[model samples]
Target chain A: MKEGKISLEEVKHIAKLARLRLSENEEELMTHQLNNILLYMEKLNELDTSNIEPMHHAVEQVNVMRDDKLKPSLSSEKALSNAPQQNGVFFVVPKVL
Target chain B: MTEEITQWSIIETRRRLAKKEINAIELVETYLKRINSLNPSLNAFITVCEELALKEARYYVDHPDKLVEKPLGGVPIAIKDCLCTEGIRTTCGSKILESFVPPYNATVVEKLLQAGAIIIGKTNMDEFAMGSSTEHSYFGPARNPWDTSRVPGGSSGGSAVAVAACLCPGAIGTDTGGSIRQPAAFCGIVGMKPTYGRVSRYGLIAFASSLDQAGPMARNVQDTALLLQVISGYDPKDTTSILKEVPPYCEEMKKPVRNLRLGIPKEYFAKGIDSSIEEAIRQALRVYENLGARIVDISLPHTEYGVAAYYIIAPAEASSNLARYDGVKYGFRAEIPSPDLIHMYLETRSRGFGSEVKRRIMLGTYALSSGYYDAYYHKASQVRNLIRKDFEEAFLTCDAIIAPVTPVAPFLIGEKLDDPLSMYLSDVYTLPASLAGIPGVSVPCGFSPEGLPIGMQILGNYFQEDLLLRLAYIFEQETGLSPKYPSI
Candidate 1:
């Protein structure tokens, strides 16, 4: 967190967390690139926003509540229409255990 | 017939179809023929929707009476590939979803069809709408029609090219940090990113939920206005969608600018902007001044921090939004014979996403990861608040803000592709407006000395799209300038 450069091992660990496999070459390149970017992003620290709030939704939003009613939805078959791997009614995936 | 038909606006297309001066088949065939000849040079479309377009046109040809009720009946329009189309493969310019055929249509696409617009095709874009240039797309980079050697700005590059080249009368594009507006400026077309919740994002492939909004891109302002009318509204499914009533955009856009006060932010004209672009914007301001509007110099003190804050906030959202592409439910799956689910995820993602996508994902994941969240994402979000407040205070003194859409004109295709930071910096002008969730329009102001199209951005308060459109419409109508059809 101290304005330090991101290490190569840290880049690989982040990639793993994101479920992405990077070539050793890509990891090195990304580590360098991300450092340059994060360094530039340090410009944000120039502003004093101690009293400012973190803004998420640009406009005000409310948790929309609707009357629960039975409505038509994408049929189970239609929902599975684009599944890369699927059985008769469900998507197929690698064993969790 | 060939040249004239390809340039017909939605209004002209509707009139001609109604009079039988041009039938749907003739119109569709004319554009299809042009696309076949021109698309190869520009690489504008990922999928042309040829059969669907012709079929939709054929329906109107058979049912002429129905045209009275449909506003955009028989008009050809291009959609960005990121928006889902029921059966048309919706690849968000990533090989991961190269064959993704969404079972439902994005709300805007559904709106287009309901208005009787023909789905001409889905345009190419940066992978998952990540980059400022289309060079990151999996299929190929979409070149600027103006000069095939240059980029057409992105992630709506192909949509901009499609309209600029007269391949389509209108196109729809999504903007999350200048995707639509930058491309529109680069291609010399009119593009708007409405107030964030004004347009529904029901089936739009999520990039950064908070910043993303689909908008209209067209050859001129009124056509852009008409297109916006069709797509603007609330949807029960999109909870973030505002429950406000849709305005009659074409009518509201006709208001004169006699007493209008336009703000010129001092920070926007600072370093990094091309001298010619600054002169062109000042020149455009003279046109508005001559038309009886007042120009006021203002300050957006937090402007410099926009790119930095946006980089942190957008990727942070994207890292979460893009987590859905894990290879099981839909889209690409790596073929490695690994029984481990985790390995399968890693392989699928690694092989599926392009370099820019990976870079952002990692940048985002690292920022949101343990220990760095408060320092990066939180700090950036607070900076975002300051930027938004800057716009709010500026609007109090002026009706709207005017600035250049990008710091520079469209660069050569490979010019900044290798340097991610530079490419990110190019979005400086457009990102502040986007972060504020305010409505903004990009209209052609002047051409660069090299003849590349330059767009002047008009930013207004939230849900002020009609005012944005009106000012842009007056500027466009007064100048009567539209980019010439690229020789390609």
Candidate 2:
């Protein structure tokens, strides 16, 4: 783990965690590009942020709450309209276990 | 006459429609004709809804009673493909969603339709609004109408080019780290990013949630103001939407620029700016000085860290937001032998997302992964806070800030394609304002010696869009620079 350098093995690990299957060529390209960006982003480490609070939202707003009354949502048919693979009213997926 | 009609501002188009001098069908046909001829060369639009737009136009024409006082009566506007349009394919410029048609319209789209604006088409964009240049789009890069070889800035490049080439009077664009304003500058038009949460993001495809904002891109400031007025207001659908009352932006455009204290951040002018663009911006400042506005020197000391912070924060958010596109859900699914759910997810994502998108997702995953979270994402967020505070202190002595939208003018399309870091640097000037969650408008100030257009960015504090519009409108009127459309 050289400072700010992303190796091919690490790129593969990150891609798997991100649910992306990278080919060998893509893994190499991603390794090179991500390492370049991460090295450049090391500029953030130069800033002294000892007392600073991390900003989650650009604008400050309290959590918005609404009544728990039932509301209309997309019908099952409409919700399934864009599904890649569906069966009857259910979205189909690969076997899990 | 057709050229004149296509080039008319939204206000003028509305006036003519109200006066019955021109009907909606005639306007739609004229734009359709222009699009038919020019879109091939410009590659600005992904889909042209000729039939749907004509139908909407004819309905307005036949039922003259319906046109009484609708603000955007019969005007055609292009939408960035990233927004959901019911039954219209919203590709977000990725293969994953190539066949995906949204089930509903974005809040902004609904608002535009209610104002009687007809949908012209869905414009092209950088895939998932990830890149700064439209070249990253799957449909192909949208050529700059100004010079076919040069690039129109992106991920809102198509929207800007559509408006620039007169294919549409105005277009909707989403800006996350300069997507809207940068393209607007490159295309020589008016583009604005309203304050964060000023417009609802309920149905806009997520890019970087905290940084993304939908805004109006038009030929002039007045039309931009009108479009902004229509799409803006509190929407209960977006939880982050502020409850503040929407101000009369178009009306505010009438206010004088007297006594306005404009800030010229010393850091923006430091280095890396093209000499010609600096001259144009300086001349624009002189025009403001002559118009009775005072120029104040201010320091946004943390400006240099804006790009670095933005890259981390945006991709971190994008990685989380984009995790929803598994094979079982909507969007693209790879045709592979999936032995298990994990394999399915991996195959779908790899085949679905483009290279830049994959790059960002990987960067984000690593940044948020264990042992690296505190050093990268958390540090970037703290830098973001400092960046915001810089703007807060600067605005105390200045009503708005004026700066170049980009360090250089619109570059050759493939120049920065391979060099991702350089492409990221192109957004240096505009990213700070996005990080601060302020409203910023890019207005055409002058043209470079090579004939490419340059734009000056006007930034105002949060919820101060009215003031930004007022200043931009005054500048547009005084310089009369925006009328020179690209000779497409």
Error of 1 at B223 (Å): 0.4
lDDT of 1: 0.92
User: Each model's DockQ?
Assistant: 0.88, 0.85
Report lDDT per candidate.
0.92, 0.92
Give the distance in Å from residue A15's predicted Cα in candidate 2 to where it truly belongs.
0.8
lDDT of 2 at B321: 93
Candidate 2 local lDDT, B1-488, one digit each (tens): 99999989888888898889999999999999999999999999998999999999999999777775688878999999999999888999888888889999999999999999999999999999998889989899999999999999999999999999999999999999999999999999999999999999989999899999999999999999999999998898999888899988889888999889999999999789999999999999999999999999999999999999999999999999999988666888887763688887887888888899999998888999998899999999999999999999999999999999998989998999998999998899999999989999999999999999999999999999999999898988988898688776
TM-score of the first chain in candidate 2 relative to the native first chain: 0.89
**Any runs in candidate 1 off by more than 4 Å, and if so which?**
A1-4
Error (Å) of candidate 1 at residue B32 is 0.4
For model 1 the local lDDT of residue B419 reads 95
Tens digits of lDDT, candidate 1, B167-252: 99999999999999999999989999999999999999999999999999998898999999999999998998898998999999
